[model samples]
Target: MTSPASTSSKKSSPLESSHRRVPTACTRCRKRRTKCSGTNPCRNCIQNASECIFQVEDIRKVTVLESFITSLKRRITELEEKVGKKQKGENGTQMPSQANPTEIKDGVRAPDTKQDAKCDDTRGLAKRDSTKFDIHLEASTSEAVYSAIFAIFSQSPSDPPSPVRSCSTDESLYNDVLLLVPSPGLAQLFASVTFHRFSDYVNNVFQFLNCGYLSLEPLALINQVASFCEFEGKWRYFAPDAFMAKCCMIVALGELYEPAYCVSPRNVRLEPPLVDKVPPGFAYFKQAVALLPAFIIEEDELGTQSVLVVEALTLAAIYLRVINKNIASSNFSLQALQMTINMNLHVAPLETSQEDRRLFWAAYSLNRTISLRVGQPLLLSAEEIATPMPSVNQAPSQKQELYKSEIHPCYIQLAIISEDICKTIYRRKCTTQANGVSSLPRFTLSMLNILSKLVRWADALPQNLKLDACLTSQGSYESHTELDRNRRFIYSLHANYCHCIFITTVPLLINLVQEQKQKGSKGSLDNPNVWKIIHMNFEACSISLRLYESLYRGKLITTYGFMDHDYLFSIGLGFIMGQLFDFSAYPVDISKYEFLKSLGKVFNILTNLLHNGNRIAHYKCMQLLDLIRLNPDIERESTKMAPVMVPAAVPVAIPPPVTVPIPHPNDFFLPFDDLLFAEPTVGMINDFYSTMSVDYYNLTEDDFVLFSDTFDMHV
Candidate 1:
C-alpha cells in the first residue's frame, strides 16, 4: 500500500484537516481573559455560575506569516545589491564600492557606504520584528496552557502587618524603652497587684503560661536576671517563672498604663502624642518578644513539642496584639498554632486531663480568633479539630466555682458558634466580596438553622448567665469597682452573645432592605418581614450601645479595642440603616426618632473613641455623626424625641425549623435612598471612607460596597 502511494500527495479538506480549532477553555474563562481548567463547566465558570461554552479559537497564522514576509522584503533587496557589487568587484575594476569613504561631502552621498548602512539597519529592524512576533505568539500559547494548569490557584491575601513585630529589632532602638520599663522587682510587685485586680481572669493567664504544668530547667541566666532586678528588696520573693514574670508584667502594664484600658494614660502626654509616644505595653512587650526565641530554644531542648512552648507563644501573640503589634502578634499566633498542631492538640483524646484539654481549647480559640481578626484564612479547620467541647464539669482545678459558673464554657460555646460564622458566612462573604462576586450563602434556610443553633446555645445557659437576668441582678449598693467589673464581665458575655445575634440577623436585614427598596417602598413599614428583621438588628445594636453607654458614663472601660470596636462600628452602621425606617411615612408604631437617639449614643461613644487610639472606629463614628448632622430633620427629631420605654429584650425563640421564602442574591443592592437617609447620594459613603485612616481594615471598601447598585425604589 505504501509503494502504491508514490503518486502526488493529496490535499486535505479544511474541515478534515489535522490543524483544527479545539477549544480547551470555556467561554466564561475566555471572556474573563483568565485560564480555564478545561474541564466541563471549569472551576471559574462554576464559581461564578456563568455559562461555559467552548468555541474554537481561530489561530491567525496567515496574519503572522504576512507580517513575517513583509519584514524580509527589505533584506532581500539588500542581498541583491550586495550580489551585484560582488560581481563588479570580480571584474577587477577599481569599484568605488570597495573604497572606504572617511566622510562624505554634505551634498555628495557615498552609495556603497549608504547601502551597507541601510542593509544593517533593515536587518536589525527585521530581526527585532521577528523576535517580537515570536514572543507575542509564544506568550499567547503559554498563557493559555498555564492558565489551564493553574486554573484554580489563587494567591491568599496577606495578613496585616503587626505593629509590635514591625518595630525595629535593633537593640539600641529599645535602649530607652528598657530604661523606662519597670525594674524586674518593681515589675514583679506591679504584676502581683494587677494580677490580684484581674484575679478572676488569672487562670486564663496561667493556662496561657502552662506554668504549673511545664517544668522549666533551672534558669542559668541569673546575671540576665540580676541586671533586670533594679529593686533588691523582700519583694524578690514575689518572682514567678522568669517568662511568666515577663508576661504578667507585660499584661499588667498594658492594663494599668495603656490608654486602651483607661482614659488616665491618655492624659499623661508625650510630645506629638501620635508618633512620639509608644503605647503603654510596648516596653515590656518588646522585651518579652526579644526573649522569646531563646526561651523557645531552651523549651525545645527539653522537648521540641511542649504545651509551654505553645502557651508562651500564645501569651506573646496576645500581648503583641494588645500593644498594637499586630504583625508580631499574628506571627506568634502562627507559631503557636503550628506548635499546637505538632503536639496533636487538636486531635487530643477527649479523656485527656483538664489541663491538656484546657490548653488545647485555648490554643484553638486563640488561633481561630486571631485568624478572623486579621482577615486571614483559618489555620485550624473545624473538621481537623477533633477536640471535644469544653464542659463546665471538666473545669480545671483552680477556682472551681468560677469555672463551674459557666463563664468559660459560655465563652467557648459562643466561640464555637462564632467559628461556624467565620467559616461559613464571613469567610465566604469576604472571599466573594473580594472577588467582586455578590454571591451569599443561601440565607433563608441556612440563616434559620444558624439562628436556631444560637437560640439553643443561649437558652441552655444558666438563669444568672442570661444577659437580661444579669443586668437586672446588679444592686445599687454594690461598689463601683465591683459593679463595674461585674457589669463589664456581663457586658462582654452579652456583647459576644449579641454579636452572634447581630451577625446572624444582619444578612436577613440586608435581604429585607433590598426587598423594600425593590418594592418601591424603601422605607414603608408595611412588610412584616422587613419590620421583624429590622427589629432584630435594632435589638442587637441596642444591646451593644447600652453596654458602651454605661462604660462611657462610668469611665470604666479603658480598653475599647477590637471587640469593642467591632460592636460599636456594627451598631453605628445599623443605626445609619435604621434611619431608612421612616416612621412618619406610615402609621407604624416603631420608635424611629427614639431609635435615632439611641444611635446618637453610639455616635457619642465613637466620638470619644477617636481619642482612645482606635483610628478606624473614630472614622466610622465621624461618618455616622456627619450622616446625622446632614439630616437636620432627623437630628432635630432625635433631639426632641422622648425616651421610649426600652423595648423588652426580644425573648430568644427558636422557630420550629421551617423554610422561609427567599429572593435571589442578584436581587440585592446596597440601599442608598438619598431621601430616606437625607444624603445627596451614595457618594457620601465613599466620601466618609476617603477621610478615614488608611489601615488594613479601613482600606478595603468592598465590604461596604456590597450594595453598590440600586434595585427597585418605588413601591
Candidate 2:
C-alpha cells in the first residue's frame, strides 16, 4: 500500500497538496474527493494560514429544514395521543394517566388512581366554590358575563337556551353550583334579586309549558297600564279602554289563580270579591271583550297591530275560556291567529330579531286545540308555516351559553308532532266529511298511519326526555324544581302520546272486529288482529295512571288547560270500565284488580284536584264515582246467581230474555255504560259535563278521537 501511495503522490500536481490549497479548499477537497476533518480551522486552512468557515446559507437552510421536521414529528405525536384518548373513551376503558392528568407527584405528573381521580374532581368543585364571588367581579367587569346569567333567567319559553361558549367556565357555575352566597356588593345583590324576582313574576303570571303555544310578554307590558282609578282624569279619559282591558285581565287572572295545592285545604272555597266600586272578574272580562274590537280598529287606523293589541286579544280569549265563554274564546283564538298570520310570524325570516315564534306557536296551539274541541278543521299546517323550531341556545352579546335549567327540546318536538297529527288525522276527518265521500277506507288508513307515526315519534325521543328521567334527581331546590318541570313536561307528552294510541286504535279495532264478525269470523280482544290495540290501550292507560299519581303528589301541577284533565278522566274511565266488564263477556289481557287499583288512585287524584278548585275535574270525578257506586258488581252478582240457579225439573216459565244494546268495542260508551243504564238512570252522564259548561257533544267519541292525538300525528 505504501509503495502505491508513494507512486500516486509523486504523480500528483503540486497544487493538489493540502499545504498549497486556497482558503476555499474545503470545496476543492470535496470536489477532488479528499477528506478534510471537520474543525473550526482544518488542515487546509492551516496550510493556507487562513481561518476556515463553511458557507452560512447552506447550513442555515439545512438547520431550518431539520427544525420543521422536528415540529411536524411533535404535532404528529400530539395527534396520536389525542386519537388514543378518544379510542380509550370509545372503548370505555380509561387509562389511569388520562383520568386526571392534572394530578402531580414529586415534581412529575402522576397517573391518577380511582380514588385520586375522585379527589381531583372534588378539588375541582372546591375550586369553583372558592371563586363563586369572583363571578360577580367578572360580571361587573364584563357586561357579557352579566348578560349571560340574565339571559338564562330571561329566556322566554320560545327562545332557545343561552349559549355557554362565551363564558363557559364562569356561566357553568351559575347552574351546577348554588349561588346562595349573599351578594358581595350592591351590583351583585341587585342583579340576583332582580333576576329572581323577574323569574317569579313570569312564573306566577304565565305557564312555562304553554310558552310554545303562547308568548304573554305583551301582557306583561299591559300590566304597566295605569289603573283608571290612579290616572289623572284627562289621562284616564284618553286611555279608558286600555285601562279597562288591563283591569279585566288582572281581575280575571286573579279569580283564576288557585292557591298552591300544598297550602290549599281540601274544602277551601273562594268567593268572588264584592268590592263597592271595582267590577267583578267576569264583568271586567266582558267589558274588555266589548272594547277590544274598537280598540283593534283604532290600532289598525293608527298603523298596524301593535303587540299590545295582539296581547289584549289573547288575554281576552284566555279569560273568556276561564269564565266559561268558550265560544267567545274560540272567536278570540281565531282573531289572534289571523293577526299572527298577518304579522308574518309563521313565516319568520332567518334574520328575524325578536322571538315572535313563541306567539305564533301559542296561537297555533290554541287554534288547534279549539278546532279539536269544536270538531272544526285545523287552519294551520306545517307545510304552510316556515317558522323553524325555536333556537336551543340564545347568544346574549358575544358569548353563548346553556342554562342549567334549559328548556327541553322535546316540547318543540311535541309541537311539531302535534301539528303533524292535526294535518294527518283531524284534517283528513274534517275534509273527508266535508267532501261527502266514502271515508271509511281513508279514515282507517289515516288512523293506522298515525298510529305507526306516533309509535315512531315516541321511539325517537332523546334519552334525557324519557320516563326514567322523570324519576331521577332528588336534591337541591333549584335542581329539583327544574327537574320537576322537565319531568312533568316529559310525562305530559307521554300521556298525550299514549292517549293518541288509545284513540287511534279503539275505533279501528272495533270496526275491524265487527266487520270480521259480520263475515262469520269470531272476534275477541285476544284475537291477534285486535290484541295489539287492546294491549296498547292497556299500556297507555297504565302509563297515564302512573304519571297521574306521580304528578298529583309533587310540586309539579300541570298548567296546560284541560289537556291533562281530559287525559286523566279518559284513561281512568277506560281502565275502570275494562275492570267492570263481565269477564265472561270477552277475553281481557289486563288483570281486573290491577285496573281497579289504578281506578281508585285516579278517583283520589281527581277528588284532590276538585278540592284544589278544579270544578271541571270535580264534575267529572263525581259523575264517574256516582255511576260506579250505583252499578251492581257484576262479578259478585254472577258468582252469587250461579249457585242459586233452579233445576231443570222445577223450571218456571221464563220470559224471553231482555236484550240490552251493548256498544261496539270501538264506541266510547263501552267504558261508561253504567252512567247510561244504572237504576233510575242516576242523571244523564252528559248532564254532569254540562254542569261545568262543557257541551255533551264536546265529549263525544269523535271529539275524543280527534283531540286525543292533537299533540301527536304524522302527516
Candidate 3:
C-alpha cells in the first residue's frame, strides 16, 4: 500500500493540466477559437476537410537560431582542425590520438561516427556537384570519361555569367518594350462610356451569355473599375497589366456591341469597305492585345490575377469571333483552357473559390465550341473534368440575376452530348471491309441516341426559354419589355438547339448519300430510319433559316458576325445536298414549296451579306449560288423565280451579278480545292464532310472547303 502523499506527488494536478496550452494551433482551429491537438493535420482540420497550416512565428525563429548555431559550430570545427594541422607541422609531431574527427551533435562537437558519415554521403549525393563525377561512378576510368564529357558542356570559370540575365534585368530599357497603352484619363473615359453599353448588351442582346464567363460579379467588376479610375494607386493591389487588359477588353466588347455601332441590313450596303473602315472596337482591342503579353508572360502563380487573365482572354475570343477572326478566337480560347488546366482549376480539390469553378466552366465551354467548330480534338474532355457545374441556388441573392443558372447547367449537358457526338461519329477510323465501309450500323445507332438526347434537352427547358414558347409567342412580346428579353434568350437557345440537331444528323445524311450512290436511292430509302433522319435534317435546316430571318428582321444579326454567316452557309449546303440528291422521293414531312422557300431565304440572306463588306460571305454566296445554277434540277427551279430574292422592308437596290469564271479541273482558281485540299478525291471529300459534321458556328475561311466534285456531280 503506497502512502497518500507519495500517490498525490506522482499524479499531475488537475488545475496544472487545465492551464497548459498547446505549442501551436492549426490555422482553421485558430480562426474558429477551438481546441487543437497540436499535431500535423490536426483533428479539427481533418473533420472540417481543411488544410492544416502552422505559421507560428516563434517556431520559425527557433529553427533559424538552431541553423545559425549549427553553422557557427561547423566554422569553429574547421578553424580548430586547421590550427591542429599547423601545430603538428610546426612541431614536426603527430597530434594526440584521442583527438577524433569532429561532428555536430545537438549544437556541440562530438567524434564523427559511421552514422554521421552515411548522412554526409547522402547529402553529397543529393547535391550532385556537376564539377565532379557521380558517387556511383567510383571507377577511375569512369571518372576520367565523365570529366572529359562534362568539360565539353561546362562553361569556363573565367567566363562571366550568361548574357540572358542582363536582357531579363534590363528588359524595360528597350524602345519596343513600351506598348501603346492608353493614358489613365483616356482609359477611364473608355471604361465609363462603354461599360453601361456593354451591360445593356449583355442584358438585352445576348442574355443567354449571362453564365459566369465574366468570372467576377458585375458589382465587383464595377467596384474595381471605379477604384481603378478614382485611385491611381490601385495597381499596388492588382497586377497592373492584367487588370488594365481586362478593363480594355470589357470596354472593347461594349464598343463592339454599342447600339450606335450596330449595322442593320438596311445600312449594310451604305457602309464603307471592310478594310477601309476600322472595326467598332479595334482601338481598345489593339490596346488589350498589346498589354496581353505582360499579363500572360509575367504571371507565374495561380491566383485571382490569373483568373482575371483568363476572363480577359475569353472576352478577347468573343470579340474576335464577332469580328470573323475565328482562328484567332479559337487560339485564344485554347490558351485560356490550357491556363485553367495549368492552375488545376479543372480539378475539384484546387477549386478554392466559386470564381475558380466559374472560370473553369467558361474556359471549357468556349474551348469546346471552338474545337468542335474547327474539327479539332478537345484539350480537356468531359471525363477528365472534376469540377462541378455552377449552381444558381448556390449564388448569392444579388448575383442570382447575373447567372443564367437554369440555362447554363443544361448548356453544359448539351456540350457533353456534343462532345460525345464528336468522339463517336466524327472521329477518324480505318475501314476494315473491302468496300471501305466502317461501322455504319454503330454510327447510325450513335446518331439516334444523340438525337434523342438533344430532343429531350430542348423539351426540358424552362417554359420561358422553351423553343415552342419563343416561336409561338414571337409577336406577342411587343407590349412587355421583360417578355422581349425572354424572347431574345429563347431565340439564342433555340438556335443552339437547332445547331445541335443539324450537327447530329449530318453524318447520317452523308452515310445515306454514300449508300444511295452505291446501292441506288430505292435501297437506301427502304429503311424507315433513313426517312426519319432526312425529315429531321430538313426541319433543322428550315428552322435555322427561319430563326436567322427573324434575327435579321430584328436587326440582331450583325453582318460582321461570323457565326451568323457560318450558320447560313451550312444550312444552305444542307439544302443543296437535299435538292441534289432528290430527297423528296422519300415520304418526308416537308413539302417542295416549303423546301424551295427556305432555300430561297438562305440565298437572299447570303446575297445581303455580300453587300456588307463580308468577303468570305461573298465567296460563300457565290459558291452556293453557283452550285444551284450549275445543277440542272435546281437551275430549273431557280430560273422560274425572280433574279434575286429581296425582302420587302429593305429598299436597297440589288447590285448587278458579277459572273465568276468557271474553273477547269487543273486550274488554280478552284476555290473549294484551293481553300482546303490540293486534290479532290473521295477521301478528301469524306474528310471535308467529317469536318462539317460538327458545329459550324466558328467556321473560318479555311472551313469553306466544299465538295470539289461539284462539276462531276452536276454533269
Name the candidate that leads on TM-score.
3
Prediction 1 global C-alpha lDDT = 0.45
Q: lDDT of each prediction vs. the true structure?
A: 0.45, 0.43, 0.52
lDDT of 3 by residue, 1-715 (tens): 9998558645857664443348688787888897677778886678778899988675443436645875786677667667777888899765542254333332112223443333234332233211111111111111111122222222331122222211121222222322333335334435445444445543432432434234546556765555544333222223346776776676666655554433333444533235334555566677777677776786664356787788889888877766555557778999998899988888877446666777888788777765665544578888998888776544536533434455566667777877887776556232223443222234455566677677666656666455544555553332112234444445555666667777667644543443444343454244444455566677677666656655555556555563566677668767866765655566654463255555666655565555555544554554454445444556566545544432112111323223332221111111111112111233432332332343422323332122111100100
How do all models score by TM-score? 0.53, 0.49, 0.59
Candidate 3 residue pairs in backbone clash: none
| lDDT tens readout by residue for model 1, 1-715 | 5443223223535553333223577776766777566777776678788877888778876535633653464455455457657877798554443343312111111123453343334332222211000000011111111121111111211111111211221112233544555445434434444323333234323322212112221122233334444353112323334444344443544443332344321232221113234555454455555555764566546363365557667766666554444445567777877776777777888787666666666666666555554444557666777877556653434432343235656666666776776655443321133443322223223444555566666667676666556545653331122233444555666676666766655544543433343354535433333343456557666656665655554444454353465567667656655664444565555563355655655544554454455443433443343334444444555545433321121111312112211111111122212122221122432332232212312212342232222111110
* TM-score, cand. 2 vs. native: 0.49
lDDT digits (tens) for residues 359-378 of candidate 2: 67667766655444333345
Candidate 2 error regions (>4 Å):
1-201, 207-209, 217-251, 260-284, 302-305, 394-442, 475-486, 509-522, 525-529, 558-562, 580-588, 611-613, 622-715
Q: For model 1, what is the error of residue 21's alpha carbon versus the real structure, in angstroms, after optimal superposition?
A: 21
Task: Report how far residue 497 has shifted in candidate 2, in Å.
Answer: 3.5
Give residue 263's lDDT in candidate 1 (0 to 100): 33
Ranking by lDDT: 3, 1, 2
